[model samples]
Target: MRKLSMAVLVLFLLTSFGIAEAAGSYWQRMAHGYPNQLVVYEYVYEYVSPELEITARVPQLAGASDVNWQDEFNASIRQEVQDLVASLQEAALESLELEQVFQAFPYVGIMDFEVKLNRGGLLSLAIVTYTFTGGAHGMTYYDYINVDLTTGRRLAFTDLFDTEAEIARAAQVINEKIAQEPEWYFIDQFTPGLIAADQGFFLTESQAVICFGLYELAPYAAGIQEFPVSAP
Candidate 1:
C-alpha cells in the first residue's frame, strides 16, 4: 500500500512539473475605453500557455486564429467592445438629437477569468465571466472552457464524462443542494431534469461544479447558483 501511494505521489509531481514546463509563462492584458461620453469598458484578458500554440478543440472557442488562443480571445473581446461602443454612441447621439437631458447613461463592461484546474495534459478548466451594464441592473454571465493542452482544443461535455449518467448524477446533487434553500429558486423553473448539455460547468480537484446563470432557475436577486457534485 505504501508503494502504491508513493507511486501516485511521484506521478502527480511529474505531471505537475510537465504542465508547468509546457505552459511556459503567461501575462495579463488590459483593454479599456470610454470611447464616447456614455460608455465605459475595461477588460483584463489572459494569455495562457502563451509559448505554445494549441488549436482549441472546443467548437465554441475555435476560430480562424485557432493556432493562437490569445489572438482568438483578444479578437472576440475587441469585437464585443466595438459593438458596445457603437451602441452607446448611437444612444448618446439619439438623446442629443431628441433634445433630451440624460440623467444616467452609464455603460460598464468587464471580462474576467479564472483557471480552475490544470493537470494531466489537460488545461482542465477556465471560467470567464462577462459582466455588463444594461437595463435596470448589471448582468453577469459565464463561459466555461476545458482544453487539451497538447492539441490546444476545447473539450465538450462528452469529452469529459459519460454525458447522460454524469449529468443525471450532477443534477441529482444540485437538486438536493438547492432543496436545502428552496426559497432561493423558483420551484417551477428549477428542475433537475432541466440540466442541459450547454450549461456552464468546470471542475475542481474532486468535484464538478454546475452553474446556472442569473434568473435561469431563480430570480436575479438570488444570483448565480453553483452546485458541486463529487467526482466519480
Candidate 2:
C-alpha cells in the first residue's frame, strides 16, 4: 500500500510539476475511469441546489440466485438494497467525493457504517463491520454496518465532499480499479449462519450483518452505504 501511495504521489508530483512523460491515449484512457458493476446501483442527482434525487437498481447475475438465499424477507431487502444503490450512485455523481467531503469536515470520525429499510415484500436485514485504515478525522476505526427492513427511504446518507470535480476524479479512480478486477470478484461474504426472522421459517436478527469485505469495496461502488454503523 505504501509503495502504491508513493507511486501515486510521485506520479501526481511529476504530473503537477510537468515532469512526467506525456501520457498517451492509453494512459489517458487508463486515467479516465475504472470498470463498474451494476450489482446494486445507488445514483444521486442534484435536481436543484437543495433537492437531490436518488434511485437504485439490482444487477441480475447468472448465479446470484444460486448463491443468495432468497425468501420474502431477502427479496424485499434486495429491492431496497437496489434502490439504495441507485440513489447513492446518483448522489456520487451529484455530491462531492468522500475524500473531498472528509477534507471539508474533518471532525466527524467514521465510527461505524450501515444501510437499513430494505424490503422485498417482507423485511430484509444485513450488517457489515469495518476498520478505517487511513484518511479522515483520526485513529484506525472499526465498526459494524447493518441493513434491515423499512418503508420510506430505506437508506440514509451523510457525506463530506465539497465540489463536483472531486467526486468526478474520485469516481474515475474507482471506475478504473473496478475495470481491472475479476468477475463476481466476491467483493464480500456473508456471516456463518443466516440470521432468520422470529418466525419458524424466517430469520430476522434485529441487526443485519454487513460483509466488511464487500462494504470496504464501497469505494469501487457508487456511493457510501446510507447509514453509519454507530449512528442512532
Candidate 3:
C-alpha cells in the first residue's frame, strides 16, 4: 500500500509538470532591414494552445482568411516592419532632397523589440526604442502587450484589475514609491491624480509595473521611471 501511494504521488507530479510545460509557447527572433539604413527586429511566437488567439491585427494579417494563429502573428509583425521601413525611407528621401536647405546630418532609423514576459498565458513585450529619420535625440518607448492565452484577445489595463479601487490603491503605492526617490522626478508636487489607468503598465507574477516615458514625468536625464507595485 505504501509503494502504491508513492507511485500515485509521482504520477500526479509528472502530470502536473507536463501540463505546465505544455502551457508555454516557443518564440524565435527575426529581423528585416533596408540596405544600409533602417532595420526592424521582432519576435514571432509559436502558439499551440487553442484557447489563445493573437487579436492584434495589421493590413496584411487582416486580409488572410486561411492562416493559422502563428502565421497571423508573423504576418502582423512583418506588416509592422514594412510600415516602419517605408516611413523611414520616405523621411530619408525627404532629408536627402532637403540636404542643401537644412544641411542636417544623414538620416537613419532603428527599431528593436523584446519579449519581456511570456508565461501563464499572458505575454508582454517592450518595444525598447524606435528612432525615425532625423531628430536631436531618439525617443525610447515601452509597449506592453498582454494577451489572455485562454481567450486570445489583447488585455487592457482594466482587464488585469478587478475594481477601480484596486487601481487607485496601486496608483497610491506607485506614487508613494516615487516620492521616496524625489530626486528621480522633476515634480514640485506629486498627486495621485497624476497616475492614470490609461497610462503604460505591465505585470509580473507578484507586481504591476507602472511606467513613464522619458521626459513624461521627469527630465530627460531621469530616463524612464518604472515603479512596481504589489499586485492586489
Model 2 agreement with the true structure over 15-129: per-residue lDDT tens digits: 5432342332211222332221212322222222222222222322221122343244346544544444455345544445444442332221111222222223122223322
Q: How well does each candidate superpose onto the true structure, as a TM-score?
A: 0.60, 0.18, 0.63
Sliding window of 10 residues with minimal summed lDDT for model 3 = 28-37
Q: lDDT of each model, Cα atoms only?
A: 0.52, 0.30, 0.53
- Kindly list the per-residue Cα lDDT of model 3 for residues 110-221, writing each as its tens digit: 4456555555544555555455344667666666655443344666766555466866776677668667887877775555577655667765655667788888878878
Ranking by lDDT: 3, 1, 2
What does the lDDT read for residue 222 in candidate 3? 80
Instruction: Encode model 1's per-residue lDDT on 130-180: one tens digit a residue.
Output: 433345676777777665544556666555445567666766777787778
Scored by lDDT, the top model is: 3
Ranking 1 against 2 by lDDT, winner: 1
Positional deviation of residue 132's Cα in model 2 after best superposition, in angstroms: 10
TM-score of 2: 0.18
Cα deviation of 68 in candidate 2 (Å)?
Answer: 16
Q: When superposed on Cα atoms, how far off is each prediction in RMSD?
A: 13.6, 24.6, 12.8
